[model samples]
Target: MDTLELQAKAKELRQEIIKMITAAGSGHPGGSLSAADILTVLYFDKMNLRPEEPDWTGRDYFVLSKGHAAPAQYAALALRGYFPVEELNGLRKLHSRLQGHPVSSKVPGIDVSTGSLGQGVSVACGLAKGLKIDKLPNHVYTMLGDGECQEGQVWEALMFAAHYQLDNLTVIIDHNRLQIDGQVEKVMNIEPLDKKLDAFGFNVLLVNGHDIEAIQNAIDKAKTCQGRPTAIIANTIKGRGVSFMENQAGWHGTAPKPEEAEQALQELA
Candidate 1:
């Protein structure tokens, strides 16, 4: 897809996220919105996915490590025809396939069950290693939040990926600089993140998370990288695309009030 098309689609996806969360009455909108652009590029432009055949062996894979943002992933999957868009209304409802976090068994396109942060990258690395061993050309892409990096398991996964030279694995970090509690800098300063990843033997590419062109270029570069895993540090804004919610840490896990949702939707329109 072209840059303009990707941007428009991302905007639409952001609106869909807001609408779904509003209908459901609760969700992690802030993170979801922050990661929408990266997901847009993956689903609409980069990844070679088969929506109808979610388990297609030759297809590329995506793992949402920060699973609370599943709403955004769900939006992408539904819009891409993995399931009927109507099912999005069932998000987080009793007995709904769309749980608070993604469940691989229930969701057709989900590659892994995620929600507990810091584990998705490990799973992605494993998948990449397996594919390499099988001689498959497919790639594995995983998204992580900056706050999730505070977990020791994430670093362990990074070390493993680097040690294995998982070139087919591309890790995207949604560095919105905010977490559930407060600003990431104040909560746990993970600054110089690019340097840290580089020291761990990763080919790091820093870019504006919301820029489609930059994201596409970075993914392309990662694909050609050799002897190391690639990490794209995507600088983003919490609650992106919504005026009142933008950069507000309080919105990290809170659903907008009825009036607020209405206003937010109006602004999106």
Candidate 2:
């Protein structure tokens, strides 16, 4: 998709995210809105996904390491035709497949269950290594929160990926600065993130998370990089898109009120 198209899709996805979160009365809107552009580029322009055949073994894999941002992924999946967009209304409802966090078993396009944070990246590592062993071309992509990088296991997984030279695994960090508690740096500093990843042998690419062109270009570069895993550190706002929500940490896990949701939809419109 072109720049304008991606921008339009992102707007729609943000709208969908706010709508679902408001309906559910709970969700991680901040990160979900922040990741809209990256997911839009991946699903619409980059990833080779078989929406009609969600179980296709040869399809590329995507794991949301920051599972709280499932709303953004669900919106993209629905828009990509993996499931009915109407199902978005069922988000967080009783017995709904669209739980607060993504459950791979229930969701058609989800590759792994990821609620414990750092573990999902490890799962991506295993997928990449397994595909390499089997000589398959499918790549593994995972998104992690900047705060989640505080987990010691994240580094462990990166070490394993680098040691094995799993270039097929691309890790995208949503460097949104804030977590559920507060600013990531204040809570648990993960600065010099590029240097850290580089030391761990990752081909690090830093991009403006909201820039579809830059994000897509980074993903393209990641695909061709050899002998090292790639990490795209996407600098982004905690709450993106809506005026009142943008950059506000309070929005991290708070659903918009009915009035707030309406205002957000108008702003997107």
Best by lDDT: 2
Candidate 1 per-residue C-alpha lDDT over 86-153 given as tens digits, one digit per residue, 9 for 90 to 100: 99989999999999999999999998999999999999999999998998899999999999999999
Model 1: how far residue 10 lies from native, Å: 0.6
TM-score of 2: 0.99
lDDT by residue (164-210, candidate 2, tens digit) is 99999999999999987888888889989999999999999999999
Cα lDDT listed for each candidate: 0.93, 0.94
* Stretches > 4 Å off in candidate 1: none
Candidate 1 to native Cα RMSD, angstroms: 0.8
| Clashes per model (N, Cα, C within 3 A) | 0, 0
lDDT for residue 178 in candidate 2, whole number 0-100: 90
